[model samples]
Target: MGIVRIGQTEITYDLRRSSTASERRITVTPGHVEVVALTSDDEAEIDAFLTRKRQWLFNALRELETTTAKRAVVLRFMTGSKIPYRGRMARLTVHRHGGPHIEISYRNGFLVDLPSWVGEEDQDAVVSSEIKLWLKRRVRRDVLEIASSYGRRFGLKPRSIRVADMKTGWGACGPAGSILINWTLVFAPKAVLEYVVVHELAHLSVRSHGPDFWMYMAKLMPDFARSKGWLDQNQGSMNADLFTSTRPIIDAT
Candidate 1:
């Protein structure tokens, strides 16, 4: 990691040496900056480049600060704590009983039943795990169902539809026509979820986000713009439940 001082702001960026070309590339994320360049590139030239892009870097860092502030609220896995589910805030109710099994169910609200032996300190971990399990199950059942419906409507048959914990993108369409959607999207509004699903399915025909791709999307879902706009406006909140931490709880494991 390297630090560059631009005016009054200090930017910390990770420098990666790539073997592809002698060109430098900068990627700005919510947390930190990433600079990729060929091993032959001099550090002085890279520092000069970052200095020249000071305005853009400053704007990006400001946006990252705002996003971090919005994600400051921590998820507390206790009773009466509101959890986001299917675009609604559902109250959590944690219950302990004498059993070896832990059951999580959602009816009037969210219910987490744990074994009596589980202590208070372990309750959070247990609840977090149960919530993750419940989310994966819902993604498998509902997201796949919705994606299948849209797929049939668009006459696009993907090789497979899988769900995982994706931080950057809500969904991705692989080159081989497989779709991987983020399970966290289940907390978004139905229309937003539909938009993501349709977006990926449309990629089955059009690979790029060029004008032709959007035109095809218009043909499939006329009001896709509204859904897209909603996501753009509320994306941070939709993802806050999962992505608030500097180190997110959900992982590949």
Candidate 2:
């Protein structure tokens, strides 16, 4: 019975059969809510099942709606906006320079230097790109360092770690040893970033969400709870920044 709903609205789903009955599960992800049916269940039965779980479905959709509304408020880099990078808040200040160089240096705080070669309107784009590139390298280095140290300790090494602008989770590990992390992790604290890395690395040892997985995660990081607390408080803000990236216009001016 493949059926899903967003609040009271029923979502269109393509029903299909699965090999195992236990695999018939419903997932309410930030991307979308989906239901997987394993056997040839009756349409009426499926509808009834969905009806029974309507409250849970409504709640999930409501939460998603709230998240969407909150994310709509973009966190763009203004002249005085305090943006956090690598656990420290950096105040943004624009400087018009003669040379074609967009430099980001910590003076009294984070100063984004924009070349006068670019137009005033284009300053945001230039600054955004420079910040993203700088932060991207920063996050990549930190992830590599943290992942490597843990890999050596836990005897679980990832084939590769990738950082990208993902709208969903902080990090994800596929069946392969490949780890995909959100580059926006640069905006988060060190502990939050490490938690995401550890969470994904643990998937290499335990593929499924079972006792073994939790045990492995605990064995590697004793302060998982604290890490999660930091993530929970910061994840929303981190995710909120992705929306702001679209506001910066990048074009030859």
> What lDDT would each prediction earn against the true structure?
0.76, 0.71
* C-alpha TM-scores of all predictions: 0.65, 0.63
Which residue pairs in candidate 2 have backbone atoms (N, alpha carbon, C) closer than 3 angstroms, thus clashing?
Answer: none
- Per-residue lDDT for 1-253 in model 1, tens only? 9987877767788887879745667766445477777788698877777777777777766765676576534345778867777777888899988989899899978999888888864666678777867877886788788877876776889999998878788999999999998877778777788889889989999999999999999998899999899888877765535624333221110
Candidate that would win on TM-score? 1
**How many clashing residue pairs appear in each of the predictions shown?**
0, 0
Q: 158-198 in candidate 2: lDDT tens per residue?
A: 88998888878888998779999988888777888898899
